[model samples]
Target: MDTDRLPGCYRHPDRDTGIRCARCERPICPECMISASVGFQCPECVRDGSGTGHAPAANVPRTVAGGVVPADPHLVTKILVGINAAVFLLGLVAPAVVVRLELLGRYVEYFGGPVEGVSTGQYYRLLSSVFLHVEWWHIGGNMLALWVIGGPLEAALGRVRYLAVYVLSGLGGSALVYLLTAPNTPTLGASGAIFGLLGATVVLVRRLRYEMRPVITMVVLMLVLTFVPFGGSLSVSWQAHIGGLVTGLLVGLGMVGPAAGRTRALVQWGTCAAAFLLAAAVVLVRTAELT
Candidate 1:
């Protein structure tokens, strides 16, 4: 009949139970636990915590609980921009390595021989192509666009989701290229994924109910830039750009709406999976035709 005489702390067996953590079922004294709105949580639980495997916590921001938010958006933006700029700078210094690294091919009939081997099946290009740019100008332009858009999107969507959108869109765009293009021609750049981020931004800003004029203007500018032919010819894989854009739009839609709880999370996962599968199918069919 004595509640004060409960089990000692799970972590510190010497201590008495002062409170119960709703999450871990461990007894925690006041000194060992912080009072959350839902219940007490140990310091460790709060720091490296995963969601309850289904529903996310409602009171806490999704990004906060997910630990995806960047502490410094400006710094992150600058770091990414700096990396891309440095790569372009290096490209200018070593043209042959840049050409090979960029994965540009000998002719439109076949993509870069080495990269084509990797990209032929649409396996390697999904991730590798993003890091490879056609030229100094190609890298610079993508980096500049990333500078202008990536920071804001990362700030709003958190680094994890922003990165997810960027990568998935890039993969989606690359898949489109592998499917649609003449398999012999080589193409490389982050433009597709960058365009996808643009598409994601359009969805995110609108969902957040923020003014979308800037995002619209930026998209228009990028589209124009895409067609201006900066990479020396029409071998730039515009199909990937469009594919990434569409992928971003779909992912962004899933991310939108204020349903951070478990119910909405399930829906988001399903929707995202379907979209990715559709993209993969396109890649599969196109690769089969090429080989």
Candidate 2:
């Protein structure tokens, strides 16, 4: 406590003149001093504490103008798009690739047709369908939609939750097809999941009391067009769209409203898990019928 009688610096005992490290309060010479906002500190104290003076600006989590901590980059979305692109490229290399990867409801033992006509092991098609595209243009359209809708949604939901929304939504779409559509028909692309996210966005925007009329109008228009039956060549599965959207709305019930602290996450994840399980059960029951 004596200003003038403080002991000499531990490291440089001969040079101390009573100035001390603000953090450790150890005597320090000018040589060991590093100026902080509050007072001078020693190098060891800097290393043991903030070390903030030399930290990069980019290391901080930045907040937006509205006092919102900007969410991390949508890495999951990008990874998804990349995977789709890779699969598309592989299909390009081998033309027969489509026949192997596209979703079909029937079970197959090998390169041949279904074994005894029952849906046994081909449940993977429900998932594989989300990544397959019949044409380069098909992938182009789906990927564009993904980029537009996915980034913001992933940012809002975070990586794991966003992935859950996307994958489960896709499976929900295929579940409808499995129950309602013919077993031989092959359906492919990401439209179902995209529609699901769009539907969830509408619900979330409304729940948050944001201006959502525009989003609602857009989704309605798309759904209407999906069923227009223009020349019957588009072969767009309105079933998938409806299924995904309904699932998205169901999942959003737990996610979009006022923050429930840990309860919010628990409910949101519970809703997601229930939706997935229900879809799986539907597929299982239908498969039993086929077998």
Candidate 3:
């Protein structure tokens, strides 16, 4: 080995291209290069950069491995927020449009409803309802909560895992509403996912034995506002809140627990999967009982 010779490609030692990574300045070949704003980066740099808060230049998007999908930190959270915002904008354009998007308890009512009634074939409401909000304040509150929790949790759990937790939480909440709420009542919101994030955060803190009183306090306050009537005729859906919170807790314990090592990882994901299956079972059992 020549002491002064610049290193060859880390991956392809046989081929000494002498190309340096833009971020880490490690020797790389064209095959190992990931294009960046300033210069080509090595695979490790690309992978590490995507997980960090640092981003590529405004004009250039960073991609991993094959240069196909752009690698982004907290990308899922941003997309989720954008979807909710776009749907809300559409609602502003037309009231009827928004009504159709909301989740009605009647569709789950296999038994009966008024023939030729408002209950339509919106089987997708179970998932779609998570994105629809009628009021600016409603969307605003939920989005704010998402913004608060999304970044860190998404970064920690990775995009797909975070999305799984969020979607399942919302779906669980909707199922709970179908089972518990009046058939004629309509409901929709991302509170269930938001609550799930909160629960995940709590789990993360609890496992680390970190101070989590604020989380507990916030959960308590929200519950109080949910169940206790406000301003005389104010109608709040405590059932959904409770459902979301419980689902989030189970998710937190399962997906974001403090346990360590390979065994912990297996248990964590298994727990998350079971939580989802439990929610699905609830829907099936409730539907069967009603039918």
Candidate 4:
């Protein structure tokens, strides 16, 4: 018999294989072959005989970062967008809410309400500021970027990992702003988190073996624009952008780096915790200096 006439794998018809599933007696390629007590079996046979009413551990689908593939990959992105929208709407009605939540290192109320800012133990501002947006154009630009970049990232890194990157990135931005900018200067926007997502996107795209030019170009352009005077009146916070970018790059490396399985998870979360602690340390140091 001509060897070319050999049957192809049932699951992958393009690949010819000599081995057959022990249970189903169907041809299977190496990728589809699972070692059994007697002989190799197909993935379907193994799943059916798993006896646990679920796919075996090996059969469960997982994201690149080892997160279980979720049913709705974009769910977290949608929720985040909703939250930012809600906060924006609330700010529209109660402008004070924006003032209360905006990232201020230190600001004294001239009216004698109270001293307010992160330096005054209002630490929540580091994160709350991320969701607070007052300008229509500001919210519009950020939400658009978030939906476009965050959706694919959430799917690749999984929801928990994605959310961690976002929050930590925002904190990283706030921490840098606190450390570098004047205590009285107030800065607020989601650009920091968005920069973080862009950083992470670079890692994901590289891992998937896609072209790097587009992403690299975008990053360089954004970084350059951070310093360029838009109209010589409004200035962007270069510190926050740089801080978030570095944090995202570090976290992204941990998520998709060489580590595998449990080690990958450990490295991923460890990197996240380290990034958070580092930002917290910066905040503490800045607060100490301010007070």
TM-score of 3: 0.68
lDDT (C-alpha) at residue 156 in model 2 = 56
Each prediction's TM-score against the native? Answer: 0.66, 0.71, 0.68, 0.80
Error of 4 at 73 (Å): 1.0
How far is each candidate from the true structure, as Cα RMSD in Å?
12.7, 15.7, 12.2, 7.5
lDDT per residue (tens digit) for residues 1-291 in model 3: 677554678898874554577677878754565656445677777666753346533223222211233356578999999999999998888766655667775543322533211124345777788899888788998898898877766655666667777887887787788778766678888887788787777775565344467778977887788878878856666667777778877877776443334465577578778887887777776666555
Regions of candidate 2 where Cα sits further than 4 Å from its true position: 1-72, 107-118
lDDT of each: 0.63, 0.70, 0.69, 0.82
- Candidate 3 residue 169 Cα shift, in angstroms, is 0.7
lDDT of 4: 0.82
Candidate 1 steric clashes: 7
Rank by lDDT, descending? 4, 2, 3, 1
Write candidate 4's Cα lDDT for 126-242 as tens digits.
999999888888899889989988998988778899999899999998899999999878789888998999999899777645557889998998888898887876668888899
Give lDDT: candidate 2, residue 151.
80
Q: Per-residue alpha-carbon lDDT of model 1 for 1-291, expressed as tens digits?
A: 875455777778876654566577677643445434454566556554543342334323324112244457456557666666666666667755444443321223224444333344336546566666646566777888887777767766666666677778887887777676656556677788788888988986665444578889988876776667855654456787788899988887876543445555566566678777987788667655555
Tell me model 1's lDDT, rounded to 2 decimals: 0.63
In candidate 3, stretches whose alpha carbon ends up further than 4 angstroms from where it belongs are 1-72, 107-122, 258-260
Q: Pick the candidate with the highest TM-score.
A: 4
Enumerate residue pairs that collide in model 1.
55-262, 109-184, 110-184, 110-185, 111-184, 111-185, 111-186
Better of 1 and 3 by TM-score: 3
Best by lDDT: 4
